[model samples]
Target: MALPDPNTSWPPKPWDEAYKVYAESETWRVGDADAIHEFYRGERPAATHRRDGELYEGGVVGWVSSKFWGRPVPPGQNRTRLHVPAPADVASLASASVFSNPPELRFTDKQSKNTIDRLELIGNSDQAHSTFNTMGELKSVFGASVLVSEWDTEIADHVWLSAYGADVALPEFRKGKLVAVTLWTEYRDGNEYYRHLERHAVGAIEHALYLGTADKIGQRIPLQDRDETAYLATLVNENSVILTGIDRLTASYNMNLPTWAWRKKGALANAGRSDFAQLYPLFDALDEAYSSWMRDLKLGAAKAVVPQAFLETLGRGRGASFDIDRELFVGLNTPGNPDGDKIEQVQFEIRTEEHEATTTELWRMIYRTAGLGTRSVDKDTGRQLTATGELLQDDDKEATRGKKILYDKRAIAEQLAVALELDGKLFAGKGGGQFAPPEVRFPDSAQVDPEKQARTIQYLSAAGAISVWQSVKMFNPDWDDTAVGAEVNRILAEKRAAAAMVPDPATFDGGDPTQDPNNPDNQGGNPDGGQ
Candidate 1:
């Protein structure tokens, strides 16, 4: 579909629902306490239960606050509604697991590869590689991310790509391939929202500026009204379309993982699934467990209950506090009491063991549900393992990383292909040609034991379980067939050269120098023995 009609309702039903899902993931990913509490409360406005003439906020949101209190906590109370940000942590872990070492991009044609290399140098500061890392995190969070390649003569001669989260992306896919997309940026100015929507198609990109409110799309306004898009008015034609000299869509849709579990059914049923999906409840529980522990710590602090004489007064209207360091106290006795009032210490026992077990269990569930194995965290110490740390690459984490890599490889290939085409067309004198999708290769997970792997490969090669070339390929996963073959031939040639260095016994007069007849010492040895 072309640009939506000016007055039409914004974000059609599918997109609206998709955005809601994105919003939920985003709230957890951001881990904003207010946003989390507000989103959950708004999500279930009627999620309130009445008990003993009091209404309490229900569900995990309220549970975070009232779990320890055993009642609804007032706004100003000492309730600790701590948010763990497990969603953010999980997404980041997923991204780091896949992108700690960015993928190496190689083109089939030498010129195409060189052109891309030059474009990357001049386009932005390692634009494609760095953007891939960013997109990985976003794909993990939003389940999908969009990559759009474009060129601006005013900015630079090379083509650049932009990555956007699913929240701002309105993608149109055909047969599992993205053919068109409309990416927009919105900012609130005072009470109204200003939006700039850029639609990318095969040959043309349309730009539209809208003056909207908080919930309404308002109307389409002239591009001149918005400074960000004002330049488009001069570059675009009457319909605000810029003719990009490319055959394929410049935008590529990258999914984190494919599944039929997208909230919106029908055509989009197989869309990408977020890494945080099905893990929100676990996230909430994790936060609740942590907050409850913190509350216990606060409530369990030791207190001294002293008599009224030990109190210190600030002012007439101010409250008083019992200070044990007062150092001065007057002796007093009640009329009917023989002993004076005494100070007593009071303390509550903190359930440290219970809280630790609960939070640890919750973290394990989060790691497993997020497709990261329990090894993602050190259960004993409760420390999250970094990507570069000693993470045991279990079957589940490896499979999930593999799936994410698969999606990343396809998206990167398509985006780079389109980028190359545009680079050639937009810059006529620059390098250009018919290029197929480049061979994309990703490296192994960061924490893999390379020495162990090398030893295994060596043992296999020695046992004839695998060929030399196969061993080389296994050692270098990012290498293409040609590169692997070249390395294998080099190894074999070195082996042959080493074999030629050994002496041939058939050509030698004597195998041992001490027994050679030509040696004077050997000839004299017989004479000395005879004497």
Candidate 2:
């Protein structure tokens, strides 16, 4: 149940900011500014993290970068909820380390250290980490990674990592905090894994230059290394003018990016993702990249400046999205009611490469992620995530809750499809007479009645489930099409006959007809019937 690989992009593509928030919280960093968060705001801390946000009872505040401080109405008087800044700008009187930001560095308690330590441990994996020896080191790594990651073919546009080293995203002033930035890129295969893929940042710098310096004055300009950072620092103050420049230079009219607003933003966030309803310092600063201090430095903003089309198709691209796929969690973790179709499009991908134990191991992973382990009565059989890394739509056999059996036939059907696809059996029909398919793929009806025993065989043949015959057909072109068709027709006819039959005990002509009809004494004939 490890997460699938990150999307095949340097930074992640545009994602709902709330999801980032949820991911941040899941990693255990609290109160660090610029931290993207992952949330599950339900009645009882709808999540695993010890510190939880208290929302305003029955009401919601919008998405923002700041946190809310508030007082409660005592136990029975009224229930207290996490306060948000935008819609309900209320304050909370009670605060703790888990949900709220730590005002100042205090004695390290085991509780607080547990989270940071856990994150540190995870970060230390050979894959990537956020620990830095100094602010400069952190800045350097963060900036370089951001720059380089855009070209990583391995990362998913939908998934992003925490910026343990960033200060712009992590500030001391906010009452609430989270971590990370979201960016996008395509993917490339690493010798072992995948890396980001993107054009060059210099191109972006040039575009910003032409838009910012050239459009306003109608003069062409050159890009100095610091020019990009300078514009980022001042862009917030002069948003309209800069956006206009961007539109002019790009030759596109749409430039007011859909950045989430704090009050307005939080309102939408609350309306959309309830998980983000608690804790906030306001996202205002989160979106704003440069401060006067950083502005003076030549450091580039951690945010991405890219084409809108790139942002729109974040999770999918060449190869597939593996670890960084977000749906994996939602499927295995909180797959709400059956109606919550979010599970429908999910696909399963196991993290292992061993073919021998693939099926068993896959199921084991599925059961594990679903919190059902070896001790459970029913163990899932094949676990996997889609290219984007999510549980494959409860494709697990829909068995009785307590019985642990497969309830949905589609599960088996989907399995057949995958198999057929792998073996290249989907296009197994003869002579391109009038039916050459546009794609080499499997159909959905790969399952059959188990009671019939041969039902699977028949259905597979009819539905074109994968088979070795496809290979034979391709390799042995001399095979007779007419004979194959005739044999297939005969087989189908017989199957249909078997499927349509019912037996009668009275109609048998076991003995001489007259003698056995009623067996007269025992048959229709007479006492002489037996002799």
Candidate 3:
């Protein structure tokens, strides 16, 4: 559905509805809504839960806590058990998925080469690659990343790309195209109501809503001080209104700032399901298992069985004097016996191997569900596996990740085309003609043996199967067709220059100055000089 007009309705219906939809979407995208918030604040869920008395309760007062409180154990002996791997792993995977290599933009039409170069220059000047990489990573975590492009006179380059997370921006689409976006920024200003500055394509609107109130329909809350720019006022006259506040009105100016959305998984019904959602169960299971394993290991090592006679000898009140220490020895008493026998210490073995196996399997599952494959964890040491192994291992993963990258690239390209078209009309005074869509080139994700690849290219070039320019391109994938052609011309020019400098054997003269020009050395030998 199209965006609701904010003028006639005062407040747009879609704005309120979209807010709820985005909130719920974000909740599902981040897995546990509360935990993900905590993560954003740099708090580990496992640590927070433990601190809040969720993981464990009470002090080290009972028999189990008393004996095992300070003793060394296999599992909880270190602080590793309290660590949560899901968030870090997810972030790492997300980073690796996008930032491993940079993307290339190619223009099919030679006439659009200047435009392509200008776009690339703008991207570099504004650090668009880094910004987009960060946005892609955010999409992996939050399920969606929205970006808006605008012309900024302040920047050296006139164009700029700004990235926003899914939390702040809400997009409305019509006929499979992004028509409008509503962005609301909330801040505190020493009032009961939180001030909000809502921006749309046409203009900016200012309003305030009550804090801590559910922003639902018919809340009876007063709208404090509504203000809008002249641009938005103009939109009310030009667009259609369905009585739902500012319906189908353009928010932005003639700029047509395109809103690009990059989703972790394409076209999901629940747009909020993040890349890490499916693996959350595995993370939870691993966390709980590690906690239990540590507890068991600690208790098992400190567990000791004592005879009642030994306790009686220490006396009822003096039993507290007995300290459990590695170097300390305790004497046990036998009835009617003068000699004291050594107490039999209870031996309990922690099933550390079993816990390790379970955790290994959980890690494998987490990696697999995250599309990282089971080889993500090393089989022998249970540590994270490196990505340098056989190409087959990462083939499927690269394919999946490549598809996402390509999808996002295409969406961004569409927005870029709009931006370019608008720039041509407004700045260049051209008739806003649409240029050919640029082709996006992503780096090969699969690992290739460079030596073997070079040999194959060499053989192909030598056998006349592929042109020298094609071989050069195969070896240097980063070079565009223009660059390849330039290099080829340069080589040909150098060869022509070298050929011009050399004397042709057919026109060569004899070393003897006296010899007749163009005559063979033997033909002129009969005269004064011998051949």
Candidate 4:
């Protein structure tokens, strides 16, 4: 390692140059720690603190500019760490999470250069989560931590039904009960929990939209009883889509997602994997039927969901019109004493054509209801805001971009199978590049083992499939949802419903009706005179 060059302008003239040099060497760190500055700055959460400035808003893809909440290392002191100051107050988040008009944002300006990449934030529980693994390269962000527990209802945050017959609707049918699911996060003093009800439907689907908005993204984990393989096969067997590439479709297999109407055939019944598999298809169908314009607003005023606002206002056009009630747009908690533009007077109205589906508006409700946006406030000034509603998009994109991952294991087997048929040529055991690539449309179970299929292309690149496909795969990891997981949940939701149906099998004794066949059966099967 070269010794520090004292004569070379001490610590390099421009701070960036010095930072760059330090970054390449072991000496760099975010904070003054000499050994790990690079990791500090590099691994550090994107510092979200920003000043009161014009924010980037209202365009298909526009730039956001704001002030920098930075902790520049002292010259000789040697600290380059980047961090979001801790949040002490709850209202602080609502206050700090600001969307201002961009004030002469210039790339050259450090503060302006810190424009947010993209936005998405969900749930109050994340604040309770102790880890800062939201970092893109880290797995812990969405990864799970399992806890062993006794089968007690009082302990679980959410409830999951294991039986209810894999094909049955939740509680609507006497036999087909719901498979309950629970998600719990232990906090310092208590825990935060979310429970989900599963529903399903059966269909031969050719194409399905990926779960687009953020609210539904991370909730795809399956229930214990449903086989992941069966769920995926059903999705592809019924609905198949073959893509040529580039935001364009080459072919759709069986049929397309039911557009603009109730699917009398019920596309989601028995569709996904597991006891709770049906949930996604129902939501997707709902998103579609309502033209993504469900009456329930996905976003609320407090959420300050930018994309919802942006899409509702304009999917990037100056004159796009919509027909949602303007009343729904009122009463977002306004910021008090805002240091910047004081959008305390925030007001907006959208114009939509007579015929365009309320698709964009649909997402807004999903965004708001799912808690897609909100942020933490600056500790010192309390005026600085953190961009939350938007899940840092670019980073999520970069984190796993074509990040070679498993679709299922047998993809390699298929390649080898094809190879053997051609007289035993060796497979390089690699795929997913500009030339030879893995087929992304979840292959059918008969085509290949769904488990192995899930493992195959999944091995090459997780994010590389047509970028559009990510949404589809992101929510429907098992490839599709089930009607049971979709509808049953909505049916037998109340816990008490379980008691109304299943009698205690332990006490179900002493009844042999089969032998008597109604004592009138005495005439047919009597011991005295058999007819």
Who wins the lDDT comparison?
1
TM-score of 2: 0.20
What local lDDT score does residue 424 receive in model 4, on the 0 to 100 scale?
A: 11
Per residue, candidate 1 scores C-alpha lDDT tens digits across 1-531 of: 677776666776567877888888888888888787777656544546656656545564465453222234555566688888788889888888888777777666556545766545533256677787789899999988997786788889887777889888888877766778899999679988888999988888989888877767788889999778888899999888998866888898898887556635754664588988888778878888999898889889998777776677887999888766766777477778644567778999899999988988888888888888776367466665564453353667888999888888888888777787777777776766556877787877745557667878978978989999999988887799999999999999999999799777778664676667787767755644553
**Residue lDDT tens for model 3, 107-171:** 66664545655667544434767766766666666556666555534444345555566556555
Which rank order by TM-score, best down to worst?
Answer: 1, 3, 2, 4
Cα deviation at 315, candidate 2, in Å, is 66
Model 4, position 299, has a per-residue lDDT of: 22
TM-scores vs. true structure, each candidate: 0.79, 0.20, 0.55, 0.15
Residues 1-531, candidate 4: write the lDDT tens digits.
111122233221222232232232212112133233233335334543334632224321121111111223423553222321111111122112110110011112221111111000101123211111111101111111111111122443221111111111111111222122122221121232222222221111122212112112222222322332223333343223221222211111111111122223233221121111122222233323342222222321232323223224545556554343444443234468233322233333322331133433333333232222211111222333333322352223222221211211122212222212211111122211121212322122111224433554464346565332443354345545464355435544654687768878899886875566566656556555566
lDDT-based ranking, best first? 1, 3, 2, 4
The positional error of residue 149 in candidate 2, measured at the CA in angstroms, is 16
* Residue 8 miss distance in model 2 (angstroms): 33
Backbone collision tally, model 1: 0
Model 1 residue runs over 4 Å out of place are 46-72, 110-116, 119-125, 312-319, 334-340, 379-393, 450-531
Best by TM-score: 1
| Residue ranges of candidate 3 with Cα displaced over 4 Å | 1-83, 110-117, 150-157, 188-273, 300-347, 378-395, 419-436, 446-531
